[model samples]
Target: MKKLLLLLVAVIGLSSCNKDSQEPRPVVPEGEGQPISVSFTGEVEDDSPRALEGTVNGSPAGKLLSFRGKGDVYGWVYVVDKDGEFAKGYKKLKVSEDGRSLSYEGTVPTTRSGGGTIDNATAKVSIYIGLDASGVFTNKGFKSIENVGHASGSSLGDDFAILKSENNALTYVSRSISGKYHEYKASNGKLSFSMAGSLILIRFRNEFQSPSHKVLWRKISGVLIKVADGAPLTRDPAIIDQMRVMNLHIDKIKIAVKDGNTQLTGTNEPSSGFIDNSTRYPNGYFFNLAKTVSIPTNTNRGVNSPFDNRESVIAFYTPISKRVDGRAGELAAFSFRLQNEAHYKEERFEDGLFSMASHRSVTFRSELEEGRVHRALLNITYQHVEGGGKN
Candidate 1:
């Protein structure tokens, strides 16, 4: 019995020793090295044609959430580390089909030293809506991003235009993004955001004297505006009456190197000449104000106008500078004049006098409040002096 008991004791001791000698397994921390979930949420704050309704159009589609890629609406993210300039780079988050939501999930570099890891506090993000992810929109700051379209270009630094081109098919035509930057810092590994659009809404109507002796409002074609300093030019005394052009035309819009159109066609030639580069006026750029509206017949005119008595509203993402002393002052002095489509016709104006198209341009300056839609009402009456009031 004692021998058997001693043998059992020996066996148990050996087993315990074997277990103690074995190496311990490693342990892992919770929520480490996991992709962060990002979600987009929010509606644009805008002025609705109806004072109480807000923006008549719904929210925009295809919102872009970029980390540090190029200035484009869509591009690759280069880095994930926040400390390093190239650390946590660019990424194009996926916008939901409805455009009401945008979501992204990925691990960003945790450190500037080069290894990729997931981090909550270090990751930052920027948002863009109603702007091209491509490097197209020139003047609005889309090319400002470093290495946007070049071998080293990133397309991540340029400012985007507010116009929603066909490229942004997912986004609404009228909805635009407020050119503002946003930061991402989520503790629970989740990111959510809201964005608003800053647009200058100009509602205009064309009033013409009808045979009935009553002034009637109607829709006309070729509605465009020129970004010029101060009011529209009356009659330039310097230029001969034949060469005197009053309204700025699209083909005449000038674009300089700093303006960012130089790199577009890969050429350095002047963008546009007549009105764009003229020393006579401060017309900085030319943009088609709105899609060409079909002319309505005289009988088509009714008590009600299109879209709540609003003939057309030009939603402009003002690219004017904010500096009061600098370009801002120049822009503040700027006004948008309607082009006299007739003047461009193969036939010239009746006489030497310039036909005031859409009457005249009003001041284009307005307060830029985030999410606020600035409103301007311009009533254009065709002022036709019989026989073309010549100077």
Candidate 2:
């Protein structure tokens, strides 16, 4: 009986020792080194157009969120260690069918770039959205990404153009992960992104008065806008009319991403002269209207208002400089082609003086802001003389 009790006690002690010596199953604390979940929670500007409400390829209209073609939206996630070296390579984020979420296919690194385990408290995760495959490879090696606009010879790509249909206009966004590891890990590693740029809405209006019954406002053939300085130019001595009008468009915009922050540079391309280099406007960059806008003739009403027709143009991701002077600076100059119908009682008025195409320009001191609509009223008024008015 004594030997049996001793043997039983020894067996129990051995079993208890084994259970205590186990590695505790190495608890992973949930979401440790797991793939991240990315979702588009929408943009900061509420009133502005939503970025995801556009179609790509044959995808459903206003349902696809991509630029140029399908699967063009590439993502670069930087998992940096304490030494600022990349811990992982580029990961392609697959976009969900709903176009609302994106996810990485690979698992997050458990170790640092060098060798040791990643310091979740000190390490950082930076994410970049809206880059193409080419763009990603071109900028992958660098610690940061820099995009030079038209002025710097680097193209902003086809996706930057706002007028390229509702579905085609796209911009880039970036964000750096904040807070502690457990906080993000517990939430399943979801992130929200906002637009890194602004929108400029240019509302054009014809507020002109007719001097005589014979001359009537017909339509505006085209509109041109340029950045300028000094005081606004006069109607009679139109600066744009004196100089040859060159077809200029904003081809690119500047953007930079560093240390997890994104910014749009205010550098713009210089305007070229039509005749010679001497006529070149250094600070002037012109954008021509894609189409002509016609104004209806209201014979009874003397003034033509934009509220009647509501014709406007939208400039996407255009950068505006901060006002140096407390007052308004001559930020933009507008010129438009004015057409009119003139009739005299005697003849068909084929040779009428006012029948020729009229070109008028107006410069105003106004400030342009981002994510807001700026209304520019081009007042087309005619002052008739007793003999013959100037064209």
Candidate 3:
């Protein structure tokens, strides 16, 4: 019996030793494709391609992939997988002077007896970038990314290389830590991305301008209301809600042209107000409308000042999808009309009617646009000139 117990102990120790011998190697359970998140950042030296030099960090096979994001006129991304993920350091990549690209190389892992099979796949990428008339990087709402092909090798983590096209620019591709990224494109189409922890999709957009790039229409008005005592300007529920919906802030609004060029595109700081948006679409356009109607005063309502019952709703139709930024020269021909009507009780004032209309054919330049609701906000402008009231 003692001998039997001793034999069992020996066998158990050998089994434990064998189990502990296996290294920490990651394997994605058999699945067609697994989720991955990639992010990069860099600076641009010139204006041609959108790629720049930056650092890359992401979960590669559920482990952090460390590498450098190389830049050509266009940009390409390459990650170096050392023998172990926790191991430090990697290789650097660069491109030729002509704007053609470069790549990164790696080695794979193997098992005993050379029996296990794993794909040794390498990435080949091509890139294109567009901006808008505003000198802003407009990507409609997102950029387009395509992979030429991924060549597979014999074993897991085998030596592989990522190649770039001879003529293609290296466009930068990246995502946030949370894995949210925008892809601006010129054509209307749907896209799917393997986000960090989720599967995301881009729906096709159809519009002259993307809603993200579209402006909210509103009118800034200065009216004298019949408030007996102290009244909070925000007490007006409708007025408060308007502030939340539109980018309406009461400040001096100045309109100027880009270098006095009628056919100008983006607004130079001296000429236009800049609109802020995400990287999906970064360009904007400014066109002149032949119609600029002014309402002197509210003659229809029983009021003392120029502002009584006067309002304006700026309207605009935005593109259905996000266009590439820096491609702002693209425009949508739109017919816009500004309509205003003021009604006054006959007993309230001498004249009981006031109305104004403005219609014009304006082309809206939008490359960095998404088919969401663009802003077309109009500010209420109450002509504060004296005698403007219908006395």
Question: If scored against the real structure, what TM-score would every candidate get?
Answer: 0.42, 0.42, 0.18
**Highest-scoring model, lDDT:** 2
Query: On residues 130-242, what C-alpha lDDT tens digit does candidate 2 reach at each position?
Result: 33332221111001001111111111233232211001111112223642222122122344443332222222333332222332222234322222222322222111112
Q: Residue-wise lDDT of candidate 1 within 1-391, one digit each (tens)?
A: 0100000000000001122221232221212232233323322222121221111222111011121211113322222323422222234445444333334444332223333432333433333332232322223310111211123222111232221100000111121134221233332333333222233334344443222221222223532232222323232111001111112111211212221111112122222222342466543443332233222212232212223322323433332213122444343222344344443211113233233434334443333443333444444444533344333
| Runs in model 2 lying further than 4 Å from the true structure | 1-72, 75-93, 96-158, 161-189, 208-262, 266-282, 297-316, 319-391
lDDT of 2: 0.28
lDDT of 3 by residue, 1-391 (tens): 0000000000000001122222232332222222222222222122211110111112111110111121322222221111111111122223333222233322111111222211122211111111111112211111111110111101111001111111111222333345432211111121111101100011111111111111112222643333232222211111111111011111111111222111112232321222332243223333232233232331122111111122222222211123223343654322222222221101111222211222222333433232111222122221222222342
> What lDDT does candidate 1 reach at residue 222?
37
Q: lDDT for model 3, on a 0 to 1 scale?
A: 0.19
Model 2: lowest-lDDT 10 consecutive positions: 5-14
After superposition, the stretches of candidate 3 with alpha carbons farther than 4 Å from their true spots are 1-123, 126-331, 337-339, 342-355, 364-391
lDDT of 3 at 118: 17
Error of 2 at 205 (Å): 2.3
Q: Candidate 1 — what's its lDDT?
A: 0.27
